[model samples]
Target: MKLLKIIIVLIGLITIISCKNEPKSLSDFKSNFYEIQHNGLRLGDSLNVYFFENEDLVKSVEIIWNGKLLKNHTIMDSTNTSLGINNLKIKVNLENNSISGETNVPILNSFKETLVEFEVVKEYPHPQELFTQGFFFHNNKIFESAGQYKKSKLVTYNLGSTNYLQEKKLDDRSFAEGAALLNGKIYQLTYRERDIFVYDEKTFELIETLKLPSILKEVWGITTNGKELIVADGTQNIYFFDEKFNLQRKIQIAGYASIYNQLNEMEFIQNKIYANVWQTNYVLIINPVSGAVEQYYDLASLSQTKGSDDVLNGIAAYGNNILVTGKNWNKIYELSVK
Candidate 1:
């Protein structure tokens, strides 16, 4: 009888000890959860995340990404996430503790071959002396940044009438390239001077001079999506920056058959980047995030109208229209993309 009683007591003690070690919920051991490794992943790339925890105490594991639950992830294995243009939020659900974190993984867009051509809606007289590098439209007016030492200037003109409205001559040594208008300021890039000149949008007066990143040897073009500025040099690389000129990201332009280099003069429209290839009559429409060329427009016939020395350079979006011009070109062509 005593032996039987002792056996019952031992079994009950074992059951109690097992129940005490088992976690009822994650909150009981939340402090023990720790992230081992988390990394930023690119679009189309696999995501590998790791964490350390007491596996026996964990009742269940759930992973959530971008508000959606990921069902097929191993506890310590890498999982492929879907492609997107924004940041990713990850939430880990444990029986006792739920932890969350974020990753700044940029999912590059897939490539699509879209063929398009341009039809001239209207042709306006452009200044033949202005070696146009960058162009933009603001408040129904055309703003331009022209290059060439001692000749570089930022000028504004009335769109249809082509009447000169304002002009600001840069310093003799400054050869201006691309121009972007944001807030109430005009940001102009210099060719070899390695300076970004800022001006008052309304008055066209020089406001400040900022230094370019040392990695960029030549500033070719610049445009903005209202919040951030996108700049390009002579290479295939394009850079994204905040309004304060802080580097945010970089993209390498990829063409269908080759890597498109010598990208000059850019325009951002409808989430796509249109860039003019230096010394070529081709304009490439690129996916900004993925660096893939979705389509290209050949303006060889348009170039025939200009002088032999003129090179296709500038692009701008004005209202519902896109405009194209070149260095020393006498006319600006309004384009219709099909």
Candidate 2:
């Protein structure tokens, strides 16, 4: 009887070991990488993701709320979104595509008090040189997308020269707004082109144009959040697309329980998205999961004129400092990190 019992115990141990599952790679599903603005997954909403691990196309996902995940869904942008507590739990499975981890981060009411003050210590040297709407400093190069509704252009501003290092004029009919470089190529969005244009980064050559979805009401600003590409419209909505540029998800920006303003020209920092609330002098830092405005930095004091662009438009980050410009301004000012 003792020997029989020993054999049974060994069998049980084997069964339990066989049932052990592969470890989960949830590091990617941790926090919000973009500011929670209209058009991202939020509370009561979820996103499905497919990725490869150990040479297998494993399925994993993230559930976001208020622009951040208090439990498992992650924001991979280099932004700082942390739970700071070990009380979080996540459920994972190897073969199950529906198994998910979800959570709601308690909206810290403190954001209303976390006063982030910006003194705009400096503005771009020539703030009214051109009607620049979008600005990005990529690989030590400055690419500015200009907008004039009927006279927009995509120009690479020469750091110290008045001449456009390399530029492309869009038929004087398409209004270009924000743009991004992906896989050695540049993608440009126009105000009313009803399409997005692609360019060869080195040649500044127009490669192709992608027609927006018929339902796409407008295209304003755009940037990549590492795993996906994000774009904004004149309204409060933002769109998410896969690597193939396929529409995957969307969210809207609202305030006081109502969609407040048009979200314009975007810059993704850390894991949060910083955007200009069209024609406003404030840069709103948003939480992507809860659609919550975690922080707002007043930039009305950033410029000498409030005199240049409409209010505020272009936003670009370099190291710890941020650079901002406007739609029809000539100079792009580099900002001091506050």
Candidate 3:
């Protein structure tokens, strides 16, 4: 009876040990136990991932993006990822030689391309000496900001007569780039000085000077959606700023087949941003929210009639008309979108 009791106790100990040491079955393992930490993901950004499974249970992990193997670890980097929708799959190899079920993640940014052309409606005389950078129309008046090392100026004109109504010369150090008229203020940008000059709209008096974020080395174009301001550098990125000039967010502007660079003067029309490609006669109509080029308008014919020194750069919208001009061009052409 003592031997029998001893044997029974030994058997119970062995059962407990076997249960504790046995590997978890496939059904017990959960796939995608990891969590991805990000509020939102954009193109040219890196995604950091975290896993919840025990390291001892995981032999290896594989991450796939858009049907391509991205990494073999928990953290996946999307630095060179392309724009648009992408599929992601995560697979984990268990220590017991079993694989977990694949986890599917959908990363998406809807971007599409559209083609557009324009018809000339009318032409208005523009000063040939003006190195036009920013152009806009408000209250029956046309406001233009011209740039050159020592010749940068903010000038206003009567829309009908094209006669100068007011003019203010910028300091020799300020190479003015773009301007936006909002409320009772006019905001102007400089090329590399990082200076944003604010002026009283009615009096043209200097109101204040604001500095841009250090990351924005060059300020090329600016526009407004009534409240917030949208700014562009020479690259594919566009920035949004609040009423107080605080950086809100940024997006990479993508075209049909490639990313649009050298984005210059900009104008806001019906929620879309119209920007001129520097040194090109092509205008990109961009959807600001998605950073997609909705349409491309070729204005190459307009430049052919101008002097060799003229380079397409300015755009503006007023009432029911869209106007386009260039640096030192003789005329501003009103466009009829077709």
Best by TM-score: 3
Q: What range of 10 consecutive residues in model 1 has the weakest lDDT sum?
A: 31-40
**Ranking by TM-score, best first?**
3, 1, 2
- Cα displacement (angstroms), candidate 2, residue 306, comes to 6.3
Give per-residue CA lDDT, model 1, range 1-338, as digits (tens).
99999999999998888767655543344522222123323344444444344455544455555455555332211144333333445455544455555544334334545668667889988888888889988898989998889999989998765567998998898888999988888999998888899899999888898999887888888998888899988887899998779999887776534567789899999899999888999888988876878898888888834454589988988777799888988888898865
Query: Which residue ranges in model 3 land beyond 4 Å of their true spot?
Result: 1-58, 62-112, 160-162, 304-309
> What are the Cα lDDT values of the candidates?
0.75, 0.62, 0.76
Q: Which stretches of candidate 2 lie over 4 Å from their true place?
A: 1-113, 119-123, 127-129, 255-258, 304-309
Please report how far candidate 2 places residue 157 from its true position, in Å: 2.4
lDDT value, candidate 3, whole model: 0.76
lDDT of 2: 0.62
Pick the winner on lDDT between candidates 1 and 2: 1
Using TM-score as the yardstick, the better of models 1 and 3 is: 3
Clashing pairs in 3: none
With a 3 Å backbone cut-off (N, CA, C), the pairs that clash in candidate 1 are 25-95, 25-96, 26-95, 26-96, 26-97, 27-96, 43-107, 43-108
Residue-by-residue lDDT tens digits, candidate 3, 1-338 = 99999999999998777556544533344333333322344444455443434555667767676567765342333453544334565566664454433433323333446657678999888887889988998887889999998999999997656568999999899899999988889999999888999999998999999998886888999999888888998987888897568998876677545667789899999889899888888898888776778888888788843554468988889667699899988788898876
Comparing 1 and 2 by TM-score, which wins?
1
TM-score of each model, paired residue for residue: 0.67, 0.63, 0.70
